[model samples]
Target: MQNNPKIVLLNGYGPISINNELLELYPVTTSHGAIGFPLKSLRAENVTIVTNLINFWSLTKKMKPENMCYLYAYGGLEDEDMEKIKATSIKST
Candidate 1:
């Protein structure tokens, strides 16, 4: 992995561009009730987002900078998603 933090966007649809910057898209298994896991193990300081709370906690604990792991709300997520982003935007002192 590169020095830059790894960004994993789970369950995202359409394009892989966030804010016009293209990011690597990793496909995860969402079938058979399997929890989403990256193809390989993630190192510390990596970032990830998942819709399931269980996966959120799992990633948060596994990845350094726990705040980088987030819970994504699907459908009608405009406000709720913003709140989650803002909450995790800055790490508290």
Candidate 2:
């Protein structure tokens, strides 16, 4: 295990896909909240991911568990702020 397992908690909706290039380098998963998303794999390096939140409420139940984090925006933050959230640090996530 990593000294500090990092989980990229990105909140959006719908089915999410990581780039093929990225998936090759890191383990990824699609899940709800920060509990069961892929966290250990993210510690390998710094990565930014895009996810869809279109129907998250209904979809989350169907999602399998992984070790990742989930950052929620919910239209409360501006675009730039979201970018900063993604770029700044793992601590923020």
Candidate 3:
């Protein structure tokens, strides 16, 4: 299709839009499902996702910096989990 794909997804609020183009829109089988494998496989420069909270957290925990993310989820992530993930995630690289 000439128009960009209309991605129906669960999350990726901040990783999908870099230079105004959507590089990828990863799907989630469920709220807690991971997107790392799918995202990495796409080799995307940017991504936008609309999913549940758990999907956002899990994918954010593993995304690469070059692959910017834009994730949107209802309700915010738990403070403790986000803290731990931010400290431990290698996404900065």
Candidate 4:
């Protein structure tokens, strides 16, 4: 496994792009019920996640600084929670 996989944390609906590459989308699942792990735990490699702000909060709380996050969704996290995450913004053309 790559020690530093490109991890993208998406906010909002639809696809999220970082730098110039569009991340592969992964939907949040509940069909199997709550798993015994954080969402990040499930991803061993680079992954792009399509999730709500709630899940995004949980993920960032324990996220490593090396990971890259793209926030497009609004609400859920507080100012302090936001501090924990090292967020990257989309540049306007």
Candidate 5:
């Protein structure tokens, strides 16, 4: 939990948003973990995580309800971004 990415809310998406400005200041790596698809874009008020990390999804589901957060399958990072992350990690799977 100490290293998890903090979740924040936006009243709505707007350019020059304070939240976007703030997020840009910090470093985000895939090591922080995939959250999910954009919920607001999906029109869901709660967090929904659309993750392909099946084992992780099942494990978390047993521990907690599927709140609005998404574990999006191949979410967030683009192909180039994913490549960069893979470059940094040791081959575990």
Candidate 6:
């Protein structure tokens, strides 16, 4: 048997809704809204949500569910920020 990874991607600007049994990744709206992805639909041992830092902070403020994993990424880094990051060297032991 093999185990695969389940990941949900969100833009962080769209609205998210959570009901009794499901969590909508992106809820539909009247003006330019994205389709929702029900959490219940994914049948996996582990589910990871990938989003920007700002959205991660927002989600934490609302609710921090147990066993839920989140991976935050830098969506848009300025030129200076990119340069700084590029200058930073990593050392592996």
Candidate with maximal lDDT: 3
Query: Can you give the TM-score per candidate against the true fold?
Result: 0.25, 0.27, 0.27, 0.24, 0.23, 0.26
Steric clash count of candidate 3: 19
Q: 28-77, model 2: which lDDT tens digit per residue? A: 22332332233322221232233444433333455444333334334333
Expressed as tens digits, the lDDT of each residue in 3-23 for candidate 6 is: 222223322222223223333
- Could you tell me which residue pairs clash in candidate 4? 11-73, 12-73
Q: For residues 1-93, write the lDDT of model 4, one tens digit per residue.
A: 533222333422233344444543333221221112112222212233324645555653454433333242233334443333333442211
Q: Which ten residues in a row have the lowest lDDT in candidate 5?
A: 8-17
**Backbone Cα, N, C clashes tallied per candidate:** 0, 17, 19, 2, 18, 0
The TM-score that candidate 2 achieves is 0.27
Candidate 3 structure quality by residue, lDDT tens digits, 10-73:
3342334323434343443234444332111122344344345555556656655443444442
Q: Name the regions of candidate 3 deviating beyond 4 angstroms.
A: 1-45, 73-93
Candidate 6's error at 58, in angstroms? Answer: 1.0
Q: Residue 14 in candidate 2 has what lDDT?
A: 23
The whole-model lDDT of each prediction reads 0.32, 0.33, 0.36, 0.33, 0.28, 0.31
Per-residue lDDT for 41-74 in model 5, tens only? 2222233333335644454324333222332433
Extract clashing residue pairs from model 1: none
TM-score of 6: 0.26
Superior by lDDT: candidate 4 or candidate 6: 4
TM-score of predicted model 3?
0.27
